[model samples]
Target: MSILPQLAFVLILGAAGLILRKRILFLKRNILLGKDETRNDQPNERWKTMFLVAFGQQKMFKRIIPAFLHFLIYVGFLVINLEVLEFVLDGILGTHRLFAPLLGGAYTVAINIFEFLAVAVLVSCVAFLIRRNVMQVERFTKPEMKGWPAMDANLILVIEIILMFAILTMNATDQILASRGDEHYLALGPLFFSRILQPIFMGLSDGALVFIERFAWWFHIIGILAFAVYVTYSKHLHIFLAFPNTWYSNLKAKGEIQNMPEVTQEVNMMLGIPVENPSAPPAEIGRFGAKDVNDLSWINILNAYSCTECGRCTSECPANLTGKKLSPRKIMMDVRDRAEEVGKSIDAGGPGLEDGKSLLGDYISKEEINACTTCNACVEACPVNIDPLSIILQLRRYVAMEESGTPAQWNAMFQNMETSFSPWKFSPSDRFNWSEKVKEEEMK
Candidate 1:
């Protein structure tokens, strides 16, 4: 209950706020570096998507066991963080249990519920760690998950375990001190999990008990604050980004490819479709498609940040399943990596960075792009509604239109589509020849 502690609390909060603000701004800037596209329409549908996909975890439920475990952690983390509001108030005012008097009996209930959730979170985190490390789940140990991705997954699980332990420790010591009738300790009957731990702290001196309680309390709050900041730099950013990403998710039919407006206009003109403003000056032609992150739509870039790297998309991808170089998860990671590189370069100098590298060659490869069948499996598999296929299509477009780099067989197919109106070497009039042959065979 000192001014010094209150001041220190304010300083810590301010520092965390400042760093978090900078990180958020950096992410926003990087995401917006991509070309702008409208995804703001259909507000109702967007909200429904956010609710079902992000909040309800609709896609996650496809796998029941993992889904149930994830639900516990998700709910526990969000619910437990509600206590942070009281922690903040107490820290700023140098008051202990600031909400205890206001809530009266309900305070005990809330604390007990929080302790239950804390224990659940600890157990769930441990289970996830075992699944990732001990069980070595195939989806988790894919080549893309080798270094930082693997370590990051384990680190977050460990951090959650430690934070949950801190919570229990704080509550247990506080309960012990309250039983001893220590000043400033609230007599909140007993938190279930903490009550179980109370025996460990028995017989400790009043001052020692107080010190342990204070240490746990400070550690829990500070750990939460640090986790908040760390998530922005980690794949766990999906925890926050999933909401908006799902809200702005593509609502168009999965098989329907989005046509380029410039190309559409040119085609309309070529077909003599009674174009309006025929005398208008021609629009400047930019790159045909996304050669770099900047050429992609902002939503596409946002998808990269929103990716959980769970490899569900890769697991479902036909390309990856059949010994192809393309991994949908890797595509997302590469886009994020490239975006961060470009964002940092621009932050350091100015606009363009002549890094002599691009998302296409340096980060992602043409082979990977061509490997995609565009079956929409990856998009469908994404729990947060990320459209890695959209990025893939854009990159493929760049390869086809800008570089004319399609393989010989693909180029032949393209020529057939243009001249024969089908991906076959035959005249348009002969398109039904196979059908006639099939009918004759059936008759025989």
Candidate 2:
């Protein structure tokens, strides 16, 4: 019935709950306004998705060592919450531990077990930090590599190290309290560092040691709460977003583009992309494709927010490396910016908007769409499995279906699609054209 530990538990739980609540509410509001339904209608697929993305970490494996470290950290961090629960109960309830009974005589054995896991978690995080700092993987690159805030990449490593040390400090304090003596032998994991400082505890009288134990106990709780709040605001927002994005990723079909309405042949439409907007749309077709953020489906917007901005897409983008006017990172940023503009305009009855025209003209340009090779590199590179190809394809549909406009190469390919069932432009009747040479060789 100690009040200090109870207070610490309440503070940690309350702060974590508040941060989680706010994040969930924001995500829900966006989903309701977005196009696709966030709910999973397919039960079988949902289970498959949960296993593959959550348990498997399939996408992360594309880059071996870092992915392996990330997987270990993620799994260990989640499961180690069991150890945290034991601390809270033992610290407050004066109980030996909650898990020991469930785990049998192996209660201390389990503690000894997680002590090793704690060390593994610590080592993995250190490896991750080294990878980000020294190797400078493409995914970790920031605007400034070695300056103030030391880049977000470095900050992430620092946060992880702090959390681990905080946990170790708390464990060391607990050992000192239980043993009522120097923690010389029980030192394990990072607690070994605290063990080396056992001389300080030996120097202090019992009254001073009691105060240190209580303060360290509360400090650990406060640290957990602060980490929760940090997670909500940081680039590590991916910790929250990655799960949902993977659950909802397009698993059923990879190549199919969503259908846009037929604007090209609409009888009443005289001035759309192909006709009225000449230079912007096309002389013959008027207007087509995304003019602004609203023209995009809800899925496109989800892709924007869901991007970890890990730079995986940028690293693999053909247009980005080739010096073309496209970068998937920029595309995601444009979608976010355009969506915010349209939202403000709508809120202000269009007064906040400078132009009366659609968002495509002001936000995403036709040239940006054309820059994409539709190579699926971005699709393959994304750790959370985002499909930039689908977004580009949707824009392609906007152009081909509405404007009746395309590059000469695309036009020829489409013509072949209509006449030959293939993109090679050969007649269907000439299907066996290559067979004649093979037949002559066989006769010889």
Candidate 3:
């Protein structure tokens, strides 16, 4: 047995692993660039959230048709990977069907199931392509989704379709070679889906069938390795991040805005509520909210990285629905983009975040952030529990508090809240004066 294939496989796997390690490290550094905040308070609840939302895909079911199609691809991608494990083992060990003899008849049953899933994934991918291109799914055709975003979505689907085809073709060619008494190939009986494909290769000679089978096998494994590295760069990073993102998701009720800790600390001191940490250094003031990625919390950056660019958030946003410029999906994408830009600059030894440009104004416009109604519709609409509303709120807070760039009307309301403890100009005692008039009118 020549060691060449095993040696080549190890080299390819190693190179892919090294590249992935670097990419993952860069992503982690980018996430850490944000200020730290704790999301570890409710461990048990977090586990449940990850299970139901990420693993079970609970939120996806809200849209039935696309949900079912997505479920097909998701399930198939997972189950079919069992066969991929065999491929990896075989590639490294210089052997084929390592599990076949151990499991006997059950091996064939497993392959049949994998084949079925491969077909399902293939069909589902085609449907996704149609939805993105032919149907031009409204949420998919948004302005932010044009150019590379559109191509990226379609490209991933096409890759899945091709990978599924490779699996089926490899199985079909292998069965034919085994029938021709090829020594290396196994006769795993006809897999349900691949069985129908046998007639196409029946006319091919044993050598040709063997070559096709080997080519397909190599292509499939290499493709899988490539996909692993590619996903880190794609919006499909959500495939892995969706788990942790959902796990650490903001558990507060929709529209239940959490107080910024730094600002809260200052307020508590002002109200004479007593400090929790008297000896500790004073909490920094003035730099209130996020003007760049660094001002946001780590989980906020995680939410950015976990975005699927599905545009459901933007679609459901009341502001966007009413033809406003606020696109929640765009907000998340901008965060991720800005982080990536900063991270790459640091890597290149540039001035990094000090380069003058910021997430505000450069990537995301003040008008877009201001247009949001803080309705939380975007947060509720995310299938993976991403909180674009949180990012939007932070941007708005930065404009209002840090730069004092809010509109005059908003400033007036701010003054009212500070003075009367309400959002109106009326004094507290006269707040219900209309009720007094109503009573007088009724009496008359």
- Report the number of the highest-lDDT candidate: 1
Ranking by TM-score: 1, 3, 2
Q: What are the per-residue Cα lDDT tens digits for candidate 3 across 156-183?
A: 9999998998899999999888877888
Give the per-residue lDDT of model 2 (tens digit) for 280-336.
542344235554444555766666666656677877888877767666765675665
Candidate 1, residues 1-444, lDDT tens digits: the string is 359989999999999999999999999999998997988889999999999999999999988888989999999978987999999999999999999999999999999889999888889999999999889988898888999999988889999999999989999999888888887898886577888887888979989989999999899889989999999999999999999999999998999989887887788899989666779877787799899999999999899999988899999998899889899999999999999999999888955546878999999988898899999999998999999989999998899989999899999999989988889887889767779888999999
Off by over 4 Å in 1: 350-352, 432-444
Candidate 1 clashing pairs, residues 3+ apart or interchain: none
Name the lDDT value of residue 283 in candidate 3: 62
lDDT of 3: 0.90
Error of 1 at 117 (Å): 0.7
Tell me how far candidate 3 lies from the true structure as C-alpha RMSD in angstroms: 1.8
RMSD of each: 1.9, 7.4, 1.8
lDDT of 2 at 340: 54
Ten-residue region with minimum lDDT total, candidate 3 = 278-287
Model 2: per-residue Cα lDDT at residue 318: 86
Assess candidate 1 and give its lDDT. Answer: 0.90
How big is the positional error of residue 185 in model 1, measured in Å on the Cα after superposition? 0.2
